[model samples]
Target chain A: MKILVCLGNVPDTTTKIRFDGEMKNLATEGVQWVINPWDELALTRALEIKEGSGGKIEKVSVVNVGKADAEPTIRKALAIGADDAYRIDADPSDAYFIAAQIAEVVKNNNFEIIFAGKESSDFNGSAVGSMLAEFLDIPSVSAVSAFDFPDGKVVLKRDIDGGKETIGIDTPFVTIVQKGISINPRIPAMRGIMMARTKPINVSQPVAVDTLVEYETFELPEAKAECKMVDPENTDALVDLLHNEAKVI
Target chain B: MDFELTEEQLMMKQAARDFAERELLPDVIERDAEARFPVRQVKMLAELGFFGISVDPQYGGSGMDALSYVLALEEIAKIDSATAVILAVHNSLVAYGIETYGNEDQKQKFLPELASGNKIGAFLLSEPEAGSDATSQKTTAEDKGDYYLLNGTKNWITSADNAGIYLVIAQTDPDKKHKGINAFIVDRHSEGISLGPHEEKMGMRSSDTHSVMFTDVKVPKENRIGEDGFGFKFAMKLLDGGRIGIAAQAIGIAGGAFDRAVQYSKERKAFGTEIANHQAVAFKLADMAVKLENGRNLVYKCATLKDQKKDFSTLSAMAKQYCADSAMEITTEAVQIHGGYGYVKEYHVERLMREAKVTQIYEGTSEIQKIVISRSLLKD
Candidate 1:
């Protein structure tokens, strides 16, 4: 089965972010890039299926929609046991545009399954995979808790707001895996990293279509208010503060 | 340049960690307090294919890399150093010795049983007179045609009484000096072979230590490893690998102590805040983590190098010295972090502290390691 996993390269959470007031871009001084946590789970699951089935994986390709900056994350995705990778060279600005780019490449691939994270941490939109599925006109199970291919059928359990629903789809399907699915995706060992260096990475220039959604100047949230402490000795004042000011009573 | 571990190595790490947390940790303190030999834990280790981790699959053992063996040892030792030694001695010192230096017939004769964990093995090197100066050993093996009559007393032998086989190094020709020593494989059932009373140790009491005696014990000529006079060199070579195992063991102990310290510091309250809020306690933890991570990286590098047949003597010595020292510091700090509770036997950190002290002394002392480093530098 041909499995395509969408991996994103983003600054790790511990990365220090600096914004230049002069230019409208975040400074990339000492940034470390890692595979998106959700994408990691999806890749690991795909690798598991590839190993367990004893069937030849046509390609464990990582499909990314970003510029050359995203290649390292693609490389790391390869390092984490993906067979190969595909990077669509276009800075992903909007969810729909990115989805359209993915659908363009995947339309002719005849891929059995396309796996992706439920949401990218940087955007937190949780819309890309669903949009990609819509663009490709394939059944997609988003926010999947578990995925299993038992008896030649793809089985997926997706968590909704209230409960989980188990859905079995045919061979060709799309799954947007959520975080905390499998054991935290393993850091590719030194050997896997070295081996990844020699593996094939297909890079293509896919210009994203113009979109309505555009980024304006980014702004920070308002500062928090100062905390007020109640005097324990003054019962009347504490009661008055609780009822009128703090509103706890 | 290939620095990655195989899938088997990854599995070994998980297995050792799982075994340590589930089987070893629960009774580790009680075992240490009572100076108990964790026979059950030893059996469990054997069941997990730990006793012969580096042995070939053809020999009924897990055909794992040297790094995998060390990684597993580090995890096990983190929970219980005593149980870890049982694994180290059996695999590194004894089984590894035979596998590397023994003839094809010898390998077929003994390795399968030892590798299968069906029979335990121990290496006898340190005599009462010999500790670090192993050449000073007084044990003798006189050739008697078909068999050699062995007479020696090996002190501080781990798994001495229970081991089915003992790989003994003895003076075959006293006049030839260090060259006179020869390696012999002696079965425990051999006549006049007896185990002295188990010694009461400060820590790692859960691993059995005793003096093994050889009085007119006859081992066949076929049992001798390699040629005569090659024993000391073989022993030292075996020890190079053994040092890596001890390094891993040290990392495990340090990792365990540090984990407990971190957990306690986060929970224990003092002066209206958790002890972790205090920079003194917090810095201690941070230092411990730093030392552990660095030491672990070195040990793993050394182990991986050894597996790849790369030049690893310097790395092994560095790892052994750094990890052993780190373990001592970390476990000591772990006790201090526990404050009053750490002084008592009820807390495991106290036991860990005692266990950490020996790692620096054995498998070549930290001082000896410095000497090795200096010697290598001089040669270079």
Candidate 2:
């Protein structure tokens, strides 16, 4: 069995940001890069399955859609235990374009399963996995909390509003993972890092896909007002303030 | 030029840090004071793959590299140095030596158990008479046909009482000084082997350190490591790698001290302002930060060099020396930064200060490292 994991390269959680006047993108100086936290669960679950299933997995591949600069993140995934890798040489403009590129790759690979994060930390759109599944014409289950592979089928419990739903699916499918899927991803040792350097990472320019959406401008949310305390002695003043000034009681 | 860590390395680092914080930190002070070795903690380490960080996966080990080993050790040391030392000797000195030099049959028998943490391992190198000059070992191993009769005294051995296996170094040929030395694997259950009472220690008291008496003990010839008479060279080679573990320990001590100082400096007030506002306190902190960053860089470089199988003897020694001294210096300064509180056991710095002193003394002394460095340069 072969598994493909999709990873998102994003700014570290503690990164300090600033905008250069011209480039319109956030400045990159002093920024740390990390694998999206949710994606870690996907990769870790894949590794666990490979181990628990008695090395039944023939290959573990990671596909990333980004510019050439994203190679390090791809390399990081490889070191984390992916057997082989692919990089679609394009800056993902939105979820649809990213999904289409991944689907293009999936059409030829015949991978038994595809795993991805439920949402990218930066975008929080939670759309790529479902979009990729739709484009590939395969079934997809999102926000999976647990998974098991038994006799060529996957059993899973997916998260829902205030509850969960258990489902089972056969091979050639996609799963969008959420947090708490597995223990935090294991770090590649120094030796694993060295070996990852030698592994092959195939890079190709992704064929452009037409899109209906485009960014107009980025805007900031309205700032919050300072809190005011109610005076204990003046009940009538507090009532008037709540009814008029604050417009709430 | 490629300094970025692989994803797996990142994962291991996170796991070790999380484990150290969750499992080791809460018990450190109590264990150190009571001179207790938490057996459960050791077993937990094994369960989590700490024992087999550098061992091959085929032997039920983690099949991790030396860099991984040091990184995990550093994280554990940050919580408890005693636990870190036990792990270092077990992984670097004992397990690594056996895996590298032992025959295939020996590897199959010993590596699996050791790797799985089912059995603990110890290395016996120091004798009462030979420490800095380790080649002057007085222990002797006589050829008794199929078995070697080992008779010797080894002191200051970590995990001596509880370890199931010991990698002992003894002079096999009485006539040939250092060249006559040989290494052997001895089981603690052997008829003539017994452990001495635990030595009372100034620091790292939670680790069990004791002496061993080998009275006409018999070891199978197959247990010998590498070729006969190669023991002296092998011991040096093993220690060169072990120095990296020491460096990690040193980093841990310094890190513990640095963390306390950073927190206290931010919160403690003196003369109506945070003491951190004082230039005197601030300068001292700056120096500690500089030393710690430099020491970390040196140690990381050494670990990386080791993974490439490069000749990094000098770098390893330098990292050990610099980091150990830095730990001692930084911890002392950390105590000074705390003033009256630093002298009290209630503060963690006092304990960390005591622990920092040992890193300079063990593995290889700071003076011995200078010799290795000078010798390497002179030859070059």
Candidate 3:
């Protein structure tokens, strides 16, 4: 069985977010990019499945719809034990475009199982995985918190309204992974990093897709107000301030 | 002229940083307080191919360059200097010595286990009488028919309690003085081999440091590292490389302390504003940053020279001396910047300060490094 993991490059969560030119684009000045945390988990889960399967899972490949700069992040995934990688050279403009490109790769590769993060940390769209599934016309499971393979069948557990519901899916499926799918993402070892340099990372042209949404403007959240100090001797004044000014009980 | 690390080197640094932050940092303070050796973490490091960072791949190593080794080691040392020392001793001193000087059979027999982390290796050169003057050796290896009988005591030995193999320097011909010394690889479990209790160190407490004693210990003739009377040169060559590792460790300690100082200065309020706003504290941060950068440059230069197979003996000495002194000064100031909080163990700067002092004293004292440097410079 061949598994394909879709990786999204996102700014490190700790990076100082900044915008340039009237918020038209994110400033690329001093930001560091990393593999999206959720997708890293997805990749880890794919590796786990490959390891747990007794010679059943043959190859685990990673696919990315990104430009040349994202190759480092893609190389990182390969270092974490991906067998091969496919780079669809294009700007990941929107969820639809990325999903279409990924779907094309999936169609060409005929991967038995596809894995992706539920959302990218920067955009948090939560749409690419399911959209890719729609484009491929295959079953897709979103928000998968747990997964297992028993008797050559894929079993997944997802959070429903209040509790989790388990579902079994056939092969040729896609999964939008969330937290708890894997405990922690694997850090690439030095040996693995050395080996990844020689591994193949095939680049392909992006498939054209119509984008349906575009951002008009971006704004930062309003700043918070400073806390007001109350006089300890005047209980009545504090009570008045809470009831009238602060509007607290 | 380019100083940028390669992609593979960057990945190595990132991997070490991730492992150090997630695994080594969590229980570091507790381990320091308890003087506990991080057995599980070392095993994890071994599994990650850290034990063989610069060893050849044919010997089960990662086949990384010297700069890569130092880069990864700096990350590990930033969080836990004790663990970093263990890796440094194994890679720069023991495994490196064997790989460079040992025969094919010896390499095939030991490198695989040592690089794979299945067995830990320790370098035994220091003795009670010989600290900086390493040639004055009290250890003796009497030649026998098929084996040598070893008798000596090595103090200040890192990983002494847990090591599976020991590369020991012992005197074979007393009349030859330094030339009489021969290096032997001895099994740690050999009969008559004993270990003293772990030393109660002021810092780097998590590393198992002990006095190793050998009484009539038998070593196979095939385990000799190189030609007869080549132990002194072997020890010196290994120390040269070991200095680079120590320099990287010192830089990491200073960097860690400097980071804490910066973060603390930003959060700490004094005189109705953050302490970082004060010129006094800000200047200290600047000085620390300069020293850290200088030390890092020296270390990287030495590592690069070694990778290029250049004669870097003088540069390695200079790097070790300057970096170690910088670590000591930077960490001390870091504690001063923290005022009372820096003296406490919970803040972590105090431990860094304590750990920094050893870098100046070990591998070769600062004075010894100066001696080496001056001797090389004045040689006609």
Choose 1 or 3, whichever is better by TM-score.
3
Docking class of 1: incorrect
Name the best candidate (by lDDT): 3
lDDT of 1 by residue, B31-138 (tens): 887878787877766765677777887776766788888888888888899988888989998899998889999998899889867788888999889988888869
Tens digits of per-residue lDDT, candidate 1, A1-249, equal: 799988877778677666678445667777866678788888988888777765755557778888887776787776667888777878777788888888876886778799879888776788888988888888888889888877557878888889889888886667889855677574453334445667887787885476779667665555767656767788898889779986888
Which predicted model would earn the best DockQ?
3
Off by over 4 Å in 1: A10-32, A54-61, A65-80, A89-94, A160-162, A179-199, A211-213, A217-249, B1-124, B127-130, B136-177, B184-225, B240-326, B341-352, B366-380
Clashing pairs in 3: none
DockQ of each: 0.04, 0.12, 0.84
* TM-score of chain B, candidates 1 onward in order: 0.96, 0.98, 0.99
Local distance difference test values of all predictions, in order:
0.82, 0.86, 0.93
Residue clash pairs of candidate 1: A191-B4, B78-B252
Worst 10 residues of 2 chain B by lDDT: B6-15
Which stretches of candidate 3 lie above 4 Å from their native place?
A: A223-249
| lDDT, model 3 | 0.93
lDDT-better candidate, 1 vs 2: 2
lDDT of 3 by residue, B85-160 (tens): 9999999998999999999999999999999998888999999999999989999999897988999899999999
